[model samples]
Every structure is written in structure tokens, then in C-alpha cells.
Target: MTRTNLSDIISCLSGYDPDAMSVTQARQVINDFVPPLATFEKLAIRSALDRVLAQDIVSGINVPANDNSAMDGYALRGDDLPASGERTLPVVATIHAGQHYAHNVSAGTCVRIMTGAVMPDGCDTVIPQELTHAATDGAVTIPAGAVKTGDNRRRAGEDLRTGQTALRRGKILRPADIGMLASLGVAEVAVQRRLRVAFFSTGDELRSVGEVLTPGCVYDSNRYTLYGMLKRLGCEMLDMGVINDDPAALEAAFRRAAEDADAVITSGGVSVGAADYTKQIMQQLGDMSFWKIGMRPGRPMAFGRIASGDKEAYLFGLPGNPVAVMISFYFIVRDALLHMMGAEQAPLPRLQVVSRSAIRKRPGRTEYQRGILSADDDGIWRVRLTGEQGSGILRSMSDANCIVVLNDDQGNVASGDLVQVVLFDGLV
Candidate 1:
């Protein structure tokens, strides 16, 4: 790609109103950029769970290793049954889960079997133990109509045929995937390594966690917040702690971040503030596209990267406000992380819910309002905003289970109006 001037970036990002980029614009910018190529690491299946698969997995063996019984029952040849319901069949033998029978089930004969025991040769039906009455005299009188041929029989290779592709590449493994692999006797899997993420916070008034909070200083949140969010995305994180507003310190942090991480995430000190050193560092050190997005609580967001030799690393400067960081991540960086891990175009969870109260908004900018959703008396889910929309109110975010999203083209939404909701679980 050629060099993109600041004016071109701004004009291209003006799809949202208020001369600011929206979440859609932010996503388009990255989706249009060159994504970092991912690598794979062979880890144990336990570790590979929830990670995207680097290659497709084919079945190594039949799903069922052998033809076995589907129930704790008696295996017999039903074709030899008498016309009447009474059929006195002498017990030819007994078959447990492991031991093999000495002989095949003969005509007018049956073998006592347990669930999961391989069916003896010549036995085509299984009569459940509860349906048959047996005497200790080596005689089991099974009703003629108790079970038919092929009843309670599990056929081998029914679920998955050998050499078939069970799971495709780029698909994230889940619990069921684990079970499927286990059925094929696969004890390990090859998965992409966790994305390496470097994160820190920059502000003159910020302090580290567990430290005493001063009158004007607050405990740094961006590091912990981004750490947790990245953890959920299966990323390996290197926390740089808190970087001050000093230009030298910020530059040094960038040098380390460029060397160690595939992506660097920072919060605060990106806006047009006197104490902000990020802008100065970006201008001097590397090419970065910084802009204000047209969304509540997250207007001051930046996405860019620096080139070192033939290699490059991403940089994201999020607004310092706690809520802004969270909202911006959901709309901007989550999909990028997913793409880096070889996931298919990851999309946010968009849900539809009714409005419980009137929500006012201008018709030019998409807004995300932290909301609590509940089903009303009519069994309809309704969503409404939390008390305040300020970026400093962490409690509002904690109290909300989802964000009620309103598009830029939509205006005020009255009660009973339908709105789309994006759940928080998807963000993490």
C-alpha cells in the first residue's frame, strides 16, 4: 500500500457524521489494512479448545470402533422365534464388555449382553433385559415380539466415516469438537498460537493498581481491561504497566512494544492535550492513523502501526475513559484479533429487543448506551439505558449486560420500538 496522507484518512473516515469515524469506519480501516500473518503451534487438545484450528481435521478412524450393543440387553437371532409370544431360548453364553464369546449365537439361542459390548457374530437383534423374564435353569423366555431385527444395535462408522473431514480449518474449537476428536482417538490437536499482545496505559495522572490513589490520580484501568479482553480472545499479553506522559518514556515503550508484540494497545494521551506524548511519538517514530470517532464515550480513538525492516506491529490508542475503552474494543479491535488468529470474518452479536423507554439521539451518529435488559409482563425483552452515559462511570458498565445500539440513520426511539443489542459476552 502507498502512503496515506492525514487528509485522505480523515476524508475516507467521514462515512459517519460529525466529521468523525464511526465503528463501521474503524472496522473498514483495519479490514482494508494488511492483517498480520498467523503461525500455528502444536498444543495438547486441552489447550487447543476455543482456539482456531490452523488446519482441517480428518477422521482417523470410524466413530464407533466396533459394532456394539446400544443397551444392557440380550442379543439373539429374531428370525428363529416361534409364531406365539412364548419362546424358550436356552442361554448359549454370556458376553460382557471386553471378553469375546467362544461361539456364535446359534439358532433358537441368545447371549446375555451388556451395553457397549460388541455384538456377537450371528446375533442380529437385542432384547432389553427388562423385557425378558429368565429362570436360573439356563432358560430365558423372551416374548417373540419383544424386539425385532437390528433393534438396539449400534453400527460402526455411522456417525463419521473414516477419511472424512470432521472439522474445517479456521473454525474455533468448542466442547463438542473436543468430543468429536476424542471419538476418533485423537489426544492432541494443532492450533494457532495465542496472538501476542502488548498493552499499557499512558497518562500523567495515572497510578498502578494496589497503589494508594492520590487526590488527582486514579488507578490505571486500561491495562487490566485490555488484558482481560485480550485474554478472552486467547492472546498472550505482555503488560508494560503504566507509561508516563514523558516523550522519552513513551518512545522507549514503543521500541520495546515493536520488538516484543504483534499488536500494541495503549490508552490515554492521544487527544489534543498538552500532556499527550503519543501524538508526538507517533509522528516521529512511525506512520499512524489517529482520528476522533463519531460515537459516544469513544470519540478519541486511534489505530496505526510502525514498520521495522520488513516487519510491522499494530498500535491502538484508546481514549482514557473506562467506558470508552470497552466500547471501542467491541466495535474496533475484537474482529482484528479474531482475524489475526485465523478466524473467519468474525462479527459482533447483534440482537433485537424492544425499547422500554424513549431514547433521544441526533440522526447522524451511532451511539451505544449501556443498558439492562429484562422481559416484561408480556414476556417480551425490553432494553433501557443505565443512569448516565459518562465514560467515567464504571458502575454503569458493570450494571449492564448489553449495549443498546442505535444506528446513525435512526432518530428517537419510543417505548415498544425495536432496537438491536450487542451482548457483552461476545466482546470479551
Candidate 2:
């Protein structure tokens, strides 16, 4: 099925205004307009890292499979321990992880157990080896308060029960997820196919990395940055290089990209200052919206779908400025593309922090300022702007660890005022 049109979705919202779209409103529209692709691939569990699960993984058996000891210690019945002070018990047999004790543990006696070893029958408590004192006659003394009943024991099916869902569908697999599957004895998994994304820059003045640059031309950095971002997101990226602003070249590039990829990202030519032909050509080939979003840096954006004969691909037309391209890609296109890849990821949290300095901002627009988060003298985390907030300044993005988000209705931020920030890097 095709995605819902933006106009149809906008009509559902109260007091909808297209000319001045809020960040939240824009996001909602995009969410409604984009749907997950329906394709899956089978992959080995180890190779499925960062891939979205296509089906729920139901546990065939309990995770531990049997009741086991969580520590190298003595396992005995709780009723056998003295109420206070200490109790001495005879050690029946030693249980290693791979082997089991054949006989049930008798009353007032304990079985020496290693970590992950099966808990002897009739034993409900464990005292670590360090917490117990061994007597001359192979008896072990455990202090009254050393452990409670069922202490240091891992119950069967505690982590995962048989016939229960171990991992849900649409979840992006991570290291912990892979390890969990391994523990479940799952060697392979079904995952959504990787998304194929084609991107390019649209400027005659832009040159490739190895190409000799003219006096007025600059090397294209957007393609390199786009490559890194898409690669990190586990996408199959097709860097289409720089397509000149000429009509024939632009149309040919768009057609080829739509035919080969699930999505196309182009930088430049959507802004009002550019040739009117940019929007005209886009509309001629597909259904698109040229929007002036109520945001700083990345105000101009074209979002819709383009067709090449029978094939079609989603299009994201970003601004020409370096920082604007990155900002727009992160805030607007990233989530939509992830959805296309069939990944159900939680939204990046916007954490609140105090601003270290004053920032001038106008109301009715959201601002994304690159910032460095640091601890103050009192160890309170605060954010400071990395440098100039100009959209053309790429170094600001590089030096920043986070992005200070100023709300659409909010004005200038005074020093020490609480502001919302989204971290670029996080400890997983």
C-alpha cells in the first residue's frame, strides 16, 4: 500500500497551517505519510546486529533450562540453618557446572556448588564460598545472616520462559540482543532487509574529492557526511556524486536514483533563491511539497515521493548549507528512513540541562544550536554553544557533543535557564 498524503493527514489536525509548520506537526505528518517496507531476509544471529527483526522470537525452552547456583558456594535447605549465630553442615558432594549431583541433598547437609551448577534437589539456599568457614571434618559453617533462603540461586526460566516471546518483531538487534539469542540457542534469525538509499548534491560549483577545484568551486563534503551517517545506520548507501543544476542532468539523476534505491536524498536547489525550475521539475516527476518549515538553518525542505516509470522512491530535498543538511537529515529524514527499514526505535530523548550562556532566539521557530556539554564547578551539567550558529559552519557540528533545542514558541534563552538538549553520542 502507498503512504498517506500529507494534505490528507493535515486535514485531520486542528487548525492546520501548511505555510508555518511546527516541528511536532511536521513530524506527525511525516509519520503518517511514511510506512514500513515489507521485505525480509534470513540472517545468522551474529550477522543480524543492528537489523530489525521480522518476526517475534518465541523461546522454545527456558533460558537456564534448570535451577542453578549463581555462585561457587554451598547449597542447602533453609530449614536446616540455625535461627541465629551459626550452623555447621556436612558437605555431601561437589557439583560442577557441567555435571549434576545424582543424590538428593539430605537434611542438615549441603552440596558444594560452582557457579552455573545445577542446584541439588531439596536445596533452597546458597552461601558463597568466601562467606562460609570449613571445619576439619569437611563440614562448612555458614553464619546465620550470611544468606537468606533462595539466595545466590538462578531460577529456571527466570530470564526467559518456554513458549514466551523472547524478542519482539521490529526490534533492532544490538549486542545484548545477539547475546540473548545465543543464550536461547538461536543460531539464526529473520530480519528486515537493509534499506537502500541514494544521495547526491545538486550544484555545478561542487566538485568531487579527487577532482581539481576551480576558483569558484568547492569540494563536496555533504556526500561524505551522508555516507558516514547512512553507513552507521546500517543502510546500503549509493552515493550518486554531484548532479549539476541543469534540467536534463537533474531529471536523469532523479530517475536513476528512484529506479535503484528506496529513497533519494539531494542537497540544494529547493530554496526559494534557487532556480524556480527545481520545484517545477520535482513536481513534474512526482508528488512533492516545498515547505518553509518554522525552524532555523533547515527551513526549506521538499518531502514526497518521485517515480521513474514503474519504480518510485521517497525524496528528501535538504538545504545547501553544510550544517543545515546535517540538521535536516537528523531531525526530519532519519526517523522516516528508519521506519522504511522496518525498525521500531524509540525517539531520541531530549534531556533538559542549564544553558551556560545567553542565546538570542526568535519566537515561532525552533533552533538547533550545536553545543558542548560540560560539568560546572559544582558538577552540574551545563551546555555551551560550540561556536558560531551559522548554518554554513560545519566545524560547529563537529565540535558539539549535543544539540541545544529551542522550542518553537520559546524566545531568547538567558544564562542558567533550563533548555532541552539531544545528545549526539550516548553510552549504550
Candidate 3:
């Protein structure tokens, strides 16, 4: 299929405004610009965690392969069960897991079956061992109302059937998915190759760890945080370290990153008043756009693709502020990379929670405030700000459990008003 151009996509969008790019508009455009790499590799199921599946996995056989007992009980024909009184029957045989009874169960006879043991033919019910009385005389008595027909029997292929799709393509494998694949007797699966992401921090005032601090320089923390985030996303990282703000140095770094990586991410030099040569160098190399997105902490962003010689890579130029860099990567670049990796996972749902204190906000732009989500006095889930919310305040993000999201049309929130929040950690 021919790839769609970014300009064509933007022109088709109704109500598009370039100067005041809405959060939704910016995300949609970025998603359209990037494409997933068409490559896959086979790996053992145990080693495929968090990797996107490249092909649909179909089951070759039924999961359980037989009707089995879910508990240690007596398996008997349902017709032999007394309607309202006690019933006693001879214990014909005992069936253990991985073993089956050779003879069919007849009326007035039952089999002592262990958990996961296959039920004998003609047996439709299982009365738990704890609910029955067994005697030394090879007889068992089931009390009235012990169990209904098919109460404890698990049907064959209940969990998965032969020729059925066990899992679809583009799913990120989790623990349960690995177990499921094992149950289906899958030894290996084809998954997308890990994405190659090259990142760097730019600024003349940035210093590396262990380097002597200059009078006006600060230690670079963005690279460390970016490493963690990219590692969590399962990308092959290429840290290019800190690039000086000199025009020639920045240009060389951009060219090398584009030639070697699928995507290039740089912190600083995108915002106004920092450096004019950064934007000029980016445009001279590729179709990059510097936009003032209508969002808090991450408003200044440069996006598009850059090229060197015959190779090209997508670029994400984010702000230099520590908190702003983290937020931009999570809210903006994360989704784009997931798409580039061909993951079809849905966006995380924003949970509705009450605000414990009033939040000062303006309308027109979206605000993402660092929040501490906890249960209130009534044990109801609520969110409160983590004190200061400045873009440069990294401590606020460190102390937050979630990001309280106020939409573009939302105004200042009252103390008791319900708000939307997205958690940093999840069960998946």
C-alpha cells in the first residue's frame, strides 16, 4: 500500500488550525506520519513478553482434550441421583489426574475422581468428596441437594477449541498470554523486531554526570529518564549523550542519528528564545514542523521526519525542562512509538475521581498536573495536586502517582468536582 503523505492528511482534517494545534489534532497527525516496520522474528513464548505478535496464533488441539472433574468428587450418572433423599452407590473405580477409568459408569455406580481427572462415559455429575460420605464397604452416600447435573464437570475445549484463533496479531504478550500459549502447546511465536530508537539531549548549559559543574550549567537528567522510559517500551536504545548547541555539532548529530535509527529524539533547542539555528538545521535536513501545541508543560514541540543521505528517521524535539520532557514522551511520543511498533493496544482509560482541592486552570488548553491519587475520608478515590506544578519542577512528577487531566474545554475545578486521571502504573 502506498503511504499517505502528512500534508494530505492535515489538509483533509476539518477545523484544522496550525497555530493553535489541539492535543487531539497533534496526536492524530503524528500517528498518521509514522508507520510500523515490516519485520518479524520467531522467539520462544517465554521470551516474547511485551513484544507485539506478528501473526495470529491458532490452536491445533483442544486445551483440556477431555471432560474433566474440577474437584475431587464422585462422578456418576445424573439419573441415579435421588430427587429429595439420600442416595448410595457402589464405588466402581478411582480416577486420578493423568489417568482415566477404563469402564463406563452405569446407574447405581460411581467413580471416585480426583481434580482434573477425566470423567467416565455416561457420567454427567460430580458430588464433592467433602459433601459425600464414603464407607469402607466400597460405597458412597451423596446427601440430598449435593450437586446438580454438570455442576463440577469441565467440558472439553472449554478454554480453547481446535482451529480457533488463540490470540490475534499485534497483541503485546503478557504473563497470561504466555501461559495461554503454553497451554496451546505453542513453543515459539513470530513477533515484531524490537524498534531501534536513538536519543540525545542538546544544550550548551547541560553537563554529564561526573563532569565538573560550570557556573551556569546543570546536570542532564532527561537522558537518564528517557533511557528508563524507552527500556520499559522494549526498544533497542542508542544513547548519543549530550550534543553541544553549536550549529555544526547539532547538524552532525542529527545526520548520524537519522542514518542509524528508526526514530530520533532530542531534548531542548525546539522552543523559542533558546536557539534559532536548531529549527533551521532541522528544516534544511527534513520535513520538520515546529508547533506550539495547546497543552501545558509540553506546548513547544518539533515533529516530522529527517533524512541523511539515503536513510531517514522520525524526529521528536521536546522541551528541555525535566518534568516537561517526561510528560511529552508519555503523552505524545509514547503513542507514536507504539504505533511504529505495530501494537494495536487501546489507549488507557482515564478514571473518574473527585478532586480533594481546588485546581487553578484556564480554558483553551489542556493541562496535565502531577497528582497524588488516594482514597479520601469516605474511602472514595480522589486526586490532589503534588504541591508545585511548574514545568521545571521534577520533584512534583516524582511524587505523583497519576496525571490529573483537564480537557481543552475544561475550566478551573472546584474542590469536590470530579476529574479525570491516568495512572502511571497499571496491572497489565
Instruction: Give the alpha carbon lDDT tens digit for every residue of 1-428 in model 3.
Output: 99566678888777887678988888999988899989999999989999999999999999889999999888998888889879889998888999978887888899888999998998999998999875444889888887888789999999999999999999999999999999988999999999999999988889999999989999999999999999999999999999988899989999999999999999998877756467778998998778888999888899988999999999999988998899889888998998999998588789999999999999999999999999967889999999989999999988999999999999999999999999999611
What would you estimate as the lDDT of candidate 1? 0.81
Q: If ranked by lDDT, best first, what sequence of candidates would result? A: 3, 2, 1
What's the lDDT for candidate 3? 0.90
Question: Which candidate number maximizes lDDT?
Answer: 3
lDDT (Cα, tens digit) per residue for candidate 1, span 377-408: 98888898998888989888889989998888
For all predicted structures, in order, the TM-scores are 0.85, 0.97, 0.97
Name the better of 1 and 2 by TM-score.
Answer: 2
Q: Which 10-residue window in model 2 sums to the lowest lDDT?
A: 272-281
Q: How many Å off is the CA of 203 in candidate 1?
A: 1.5
Off by over 4 Å in 1: 1-18, 34-36, 77-91, 100-103, 106-108, 131-149, 308-311, 375-379
Q: On a 0 to 1 TM-score scale, where does candidate 3 land against the true structure?
A: 0.97
Q: Considering TM-score, where higher is better, how would the candidates rank from best to worst?
A: 3, 2, 1
TM-score of model 2 vs. true structure: 0.97
Reference-based lDDT, residue 36, model 1: 42
| C-alpha lDDT values of all predictions | 0.81, 0.88, 0.90
